[model samples]
Target: MDFNKIKEMGLEYAEKGKNAALDLAEKGRTQAKIVNAQSKLYKAQRQLGALVYSLAKGNEENQPLVDKYIEMIANIEQEISDLKASLEPDTVIETTFEDTEEAADGTADAAAEPAEEKPEDDEAKTCPQCGAPVSDDALFCNKCGAQL
Candidate 1:
């Protein structure tokens, strides 16, 4: 084999390897985004579900809130699918962040525009869904949507 030809083939293979590594890294990053976004989405849904269950117990009209959260979850799911399809270098991944304490103050209007979330942690509560730490009295798992 000619030395120059061997050098040329090595350079080509090295370039191909670099491109493949970059693609793999992008996929890994996209997967992390998907997982984190889905976790937040489930937390939001669980909180809203608890609220609805509470309000519904008192026979209060929570359909509007329920509908809103349903739409929000749908939007999150759509974004997740979009992010999955957007692992390319030119695509932007949009993730949604929702506050889990939206209903913590026990006000109807508190559910309005949510801010950033603060995750709760406790040693006793093992989430049946994701096995993450949660509060003992939690109605829903903070990490996942497991009914406790």
Candidate 2:
């Protein structure tokens, strides 16, 4: 087993996972912003409906109610403005591992290659007594040693 090759492959996988996680986070932020905007629009429409109802039933008793509704609408509009300003999409600056100095060598780094494992060959020697396969360079079999 080549330990260096394993380490390189692990590093490559880790980098890809990191980038994917960051992309998901960015997408979530965008969706949240859109949902928030829709909620604010719905609330504003409801406030407008209340204002129209109060105007249609004008009376001295309803004057205070109309004033309160106007103030509430103003507050909601301010809140929506602030939310719009705050809901800007999070900016992400993409980076690449290939931008490093080692990547300038132009040999297409081995870490970028897919793993190609070969099957193990049958090169073991057989024990005389137990007939079990032993390592080719072994001096004796672990089980039933027959001077292998």
Candidate 3:
């Protein structure tokens, strides 16, 4: 029934929303990096394959170039692995003395309210090639690199 309490509740919800948006943005950036690394990895592998094939046809070998490609590919793979690991959802535990005090005072209901999240719609579109969820705005599937 207090106006100040209602205002505080609104501010809390707003803060939670802002934090969730920032988290989502960070996740999107990580996913984009993974996709870029995947593209580079594919290109390096293809080049290595071509070089090996040409060398076999000519009965020649370039150990140095081959080694370079191998090293580059390994590094790219490691980067992709790290980025993908970062994409894994994080578990955040946020607790403070104020939270404990509020709970003891039976005012924790404001904090207990669930954060807003976009739900999966019944009509959500999926990638035809990989069956992974794809946003309507996406030109390519994030999971399997399929054209959407």
Candidate 4:
């Protein structure tokens, strides 16, 4: 109940709060670095794979060097996969590739591309009375007529 003691206690709390904030900021910066690294790795892997595919398309003579690049790309992909798995152990990552649209001759259109479907979560509220799905603004459960 001394003025000096109260000021010292307040200062201590302030310092603790400041340190916690700094720690959180450092964590944010580290997370950003991890995201940037993952993006760069993916870009590099795609570029190398494209190069190998183009080489194989042009001639058979470039097979040896293309094989080498393909091997390196595979290793890079494996490493990226392992690192991603470790970084996001609790996250479920799914990749869905759609079939390219076809032409009149039953062949795929040269310009047509496969689309990726994004997974979406249902945001509607569920009724506790009968476990029925309901709109978020509902005042009563539609099935059981129970008040929400």
Candidate number with greatest lDDT: 3
> Which number leads on TM-score?
3
Candidate 1 root-mean-square deviation in Å = 11.8
What is the overall TM-score of model 1 with all chains considered together? Answer: 0.54
Candidate 4 ranges beyond 4 A from true positions: 1-3, 60-148
Per-structure clash totals for the candidates: 0, 0, 0, 0
lDDT for model 1, please.
Answer: 0.58
- Window of ten residues with lowest summed lDDT in model 2: 95-104
- Go through the candidates in order and give each one's C-alpha lDDT: 0.58, 0.47, 0.61, 0.47
TM-score of every prediction relative to native: 0.54, 0.33, 0.57, 0.38
**Which of 2 and 3 is ahead in TM-score?**
3
lDDT of 4 by residue, 46-65 (tens): 55456456546765344554
Runs with alpha carbons beyond 4 Å of true place in candidate 2: 1-6, 56-148
Ranking by lDDT: 3, 1, 2, 4
Candidate 1: residue 9 Cα off by (Å):
1.3
In model 4, the worst 10-residue window by lDDT is 96-105
Model 3: per-residue Cα lDDT at residue 12: 100
How good is model 3 by TM-score?
0.57
Candidate 1 per-residue lDDT, tens place, 1-148, comes to 6999999999999999998997787677557656766765776688677867877788887565566667767766765766666665555433211221221222222233233123443336577779987654444554445554
Tell me the lDDT of candidate 3.
0.61
